[model samples]
Target chain A: MGSRLPTGWRDVQVAARAVRLVLTRPAYATAAVVAAWASLTVFVLSGNIAMVRNLVVSGPLSPGDRLVLVREQYPFLGTNYGTLEGVAVLAVAALAGANLALVAYHLREHELSASEGGGSLVGVVLGVVGAGCAACGSALLVGVASLLGVSGLLLRFPFGGLELSALAVLALVVSTYWIAHGLRGGEVGGCPVDVGGRR
Target chain B: MKQTSRSDRERTAGVDDGRPARRGGREPEGGSRSRRRLLLALGGVSTIAVAGCLGNGGGEADGDEDAGSEGGNEDGGGEGADGETLESHPVGVDLAEKPRLGPDPFDAPATLVVLDDPSCPRCAAYHQGTVAELRESHVAAGELSIVYRPYPVVYDWGERAAHALEATVERDPEAFWPLLGYYFDEQSSFTSDTVLERTASWLTAETDLDAAGIVADAREETFADRIETTLEAGSAAGAGGVTPVSYTFVDGVFQSPINGSASTTAIETALQL
Candidate 1:
């Protein structure tokens, strides 16, 4: 096995290749996949919120009122996706998710190139943070605060009374630009050619 | 420089052999190892992303379970406790008995009962105009006790919201009309899905009642029956077909059921003012 890989330009070249692949024909394909994933993520997360609301306000669903598991997965979309407005929102959210997927993809690739194996590490951190925020119980909080007339006081602080709407925007931003600068500067930390031809 | 030299030699070796590095071509062992490592890293990152999504899904499902259990816990009052026994008090009216609004066998000279739905826009308009006027002019003066029996005919959501209004009677009888007025004032926001949110918010903000407790109670089918009994009462009195129907009673005798949005003048005339 080849060892003692140099910390330099060949890695940059490989990253450039990845970026070129991303920006060229593969860019469309990557974005399309990411967008589809992002949209589904939004739907699932929102659906969970709706499910909780139903349970809280209506108690256990009788067999007659039980929602179809598969059909209920998309929450708002599943309920109103046939409507024009619902379709429009889903389309917009998917576009935002696509942008996010691009940023995440590039970030992971760059981290993998580093000697420290930080790519997977970064992914773990992101997964924890993203899951926490996406599933935050801000809806109930805000609803309570609005009722209490203290929303201004409670929700103003960071992560104190955070809302789902803010978390969603943050998800869109992180996904769109986490590795934006790295991609633009044409940097890649690791490359296959960095290994000398030793088997 | 050493790495460059190694790469250069490898390229030369390939060229000398009359082959060039090509896409999908067999890689030397070290390059293959590097490709494998790279794929592993990508795989790990993708796995994390997938796990994060799944985690959110799981979290929400868990929350639903918790909320369901919580709701069940508060429903200890059984499923059929009609809130009728809860004593209701209007401003300046103090009696040991539950003060029946509109019409009752309370030995009162006259009772003006308004059958309205929380979801009815016309009822909302009447409440804002006629009902408010009545509250200030007759109710405050003790000339008449205007009782609002929810007709619940506008829609299913309207019935549920009316149940929430009835829920307030059990906890805060003083807030009964105020809660109904709040529902009427924000009438557009009351949907089957949104009734709980709206009720909880208003109760939390405007009343000292436990918002969650109210939600837990209102979610019970028993609480819904409280509103159902009132509906039955309205139907028995021949005032269930259309909402905003006013029934005037003089000395415990039913006079007439005035349908549609009757003006304060028409209502007063029906009350024999």
Candidate 2:
């Protein structure tokens, strides 16, 4: 506890410490991994549920074949991971995992309310929409914009709406920092307070 | 000893007492100020991002308008009495021999030409949603015909899928729809490396067509020229790299070009149905 540390640096340290503490627990670590996998799956298959349904209902495919298929199709958001857009998707998935893990930690330890995790929830939603498509545009955003007869407007995004994914990344970072600050300051669900300014 | 409630203890200790501190009491001044700053920063970033998107869109729109005006000037002397140049009008393509669904193109009141890439998810969506509805209502009623042009714009797998489609169409025309439907339905399960082999296996198991010969034809690139012709046709229509670009023709005259996933209502309006 460097009392004289700058506020921003202290906030980062606290958040990092809180994340480390939560992930050190096997249960929370598993939850984080599972949540990250689930979030990535949702991001990839959001607009393509029929493909999954077909694979499941159709004739049996070998495990190796299925794995290859997933690998090939995993970059549905764009061409491949070589591009900035594809990297953004991976970033979103990772940040989403960490944010959710922290939220879960707070809920379990501090009895955090659903409303308190609203930021994390919004981050997840934005991640999904932002990771839609780097080339053509976000499928969900396009659908919504099509209703307003402005779907063409999405074409104007400099990175083809990769900015939205960037926004999601920023949002998760902020949420992570906020939760960490709460944990460090003992401001969340009732932790023992040190009135004498003692740690 | 004075009885102290949990809240009293929390107040004395400056610690969270298993209750949300942000809610029922005055939040710490530092935390409150930090939160405000974060929110303001987020809002500022969001504003800038939105502005950038709008700025790009507006700039592109203006550029397109400028190009349109330039084209108009170049063709000023060729304008008809209605001030519309022949090039400005949508031209209908001959679909008499194209792979199609519903009534014969010559007999139907309208024909919708669909250019799609098999690996494109939006094309799949358009096929599943808008095309299905049209097939039930207009195609069933013989009011409309639909011609499918396999345009591979997404991945190498799309070209392979297109080749497979061409083979299927040439070998057993009736099996073409089912094969195309299978490709769209299970798009993610196939890649450039595996599409032809997997398609051959699926066709062998599912259809009566000579799947072995079809696969051989695809491997031999028997229909590469035909696919190239379709690709050129799509490019000539200004489709760019977008998939599921639809062209509607009512009474043998091109009405509109719909980009991306066109809705059933949009197709209906385009056809004046």
Candidate 3:
């Protein structure tokens, strides 16, 4: 039944609410779980992209050929992330984010229906923006780190944290949706009639 | 089925343990908008970033680096001997000085030209066989001059690569050979922003060229026309759409597409050896 939420610290709050909603609203959990599965598949495929290149098409190409492909396939990673390998990390982030959002939504809706107002709507918006900024910042840090060490270190671990954070964001989105749904119902004492639980 | 309502569809979409979660059909307008924007932005950034990383793995540099690891690799004088010489001094990204264009490199002692996609699988094989011969023997003798006009057909990264070649020829330490060697080196990393950035660093460190300028020149603005010309030229030469188009130009006349894919004996027989 939390009403007013704090400002600025949006990202952290979203993360907290997302985990809480995973229990009952299995709908959100299903989305998150599916996304997780997809993300893992992409990660594995990303790892094998190199071998696929060598064995299938573009086999044993020259350095020039290799460079050309990198530039075309991944534009954002080129400008940041320090190396081409960061593309895989980005994929993981997307899948994880979607999964968490679904799980959170289901939970939030359940709480709201049971007469608890749940997370504030403003909180969800702020959380999303904060997560985005953090993702960008993390990518920047990886590139800066390359300046200090042998640039190859970037090849080993690129902006993979984006994937992890994405899951948290997904969770938040799900939770927020459910909470709002519950609030519209009689879940909040003020509604008088059970709008959230009407169905 | 009577068309399911939007909310019902959404309910179905949000399946939990094979059951649709019930909702009051009262989605908050403002919250949904924000959520939508955030998701879109995240998806976009992820695609760009991921494409950049895998594309920059540096597989493209393997070939050229193997050849230009030493100064002897550049021993073949720029003079037109057998017309098969390949040099990297003209292809660096950091062009400290404008690349001196001698006679049309295509018109030199009559080495062959393969204006093909840097990432096509067939192109790699040609590099392995006859390209090796054209580069090592004839070019070393200075009897031939090889000109590489990269036409990126296999992927979008091809365009940036073509520009990078021009950049190397125009500015970097006459290390065109090193950059030229890189053409096939990082094919897998092509078209990815990360690979392009990595190439920027590699070009800077290896050739001591201006990395930033080259990147600026390649990116932000699309220099796709240059690639178009190469493609047009290849098509005009009657190169079948299939890649690894191998054709030699002896003196100034354009010869027919040669079979470089054949074994040495087949090529020797075709050459009437």
Q: Local distance difference test, per candidate?
A: 0.44, 0.58, 0.40
Residue A63 C-alpha lDDT in model 2: 58
lDDT of 3 by residue, B129-229 (tens): 55676556656666555555564544455556667766666565256556655756765555555656866888878866788887787775354555555
Winning model by DockQ: 1
Q: DockQ: which is higher, 1 or 2?
A: 1
Candidate 3 lDDT score at position B65: 31
For model 2 chain B, the run of ten residues with the poorest summed lDDT: B70-79
Alpha-carbon error at A82 in model 1, in Å? 33
What TM-score does chain B of candidate 3 reach?
Answer: 0.53
The per-model DockQ list reads 0.08, 0.04, 0.05
Stretches > 4 Å off in candidate 2: A1-199, B1-94
Task: For residues B129-177, write the lDDT of model 1, one tens digit per residue.
Answer: 7677776776666667676666565555777777676676777777787
Per-residue CA lDDT of model 3 for A1-199, tens digit only, reads 2432222355335433434444344665566667655553333323223322432234333565444433322314222121222443443344344434532453444222221222222222223222221222222223223334532443233342343334444443444444333322312222222333233
Stretches > 4 Å off in candidate 3: A1-199, B1-109, B172-174, B189-191, B221-223, B259-273
Give lDDT for model 1: 0.44
**Winner by lDDT:** 2
Q: Which stretches of candidate 1 lie over 4 Å from their true place?
A: A1-199, B1-105
Model 2 agreement with the true structure over A1-199: per-residue lDDT tens digits: 2332224765566567667776777887888888887777666544332222322223234455334434443453223222576678778888888888877665444333333355676677677666545423333344434435675665345455688788888777767766665544444422122223312
Error of 2 at B109 (Å): 2.5
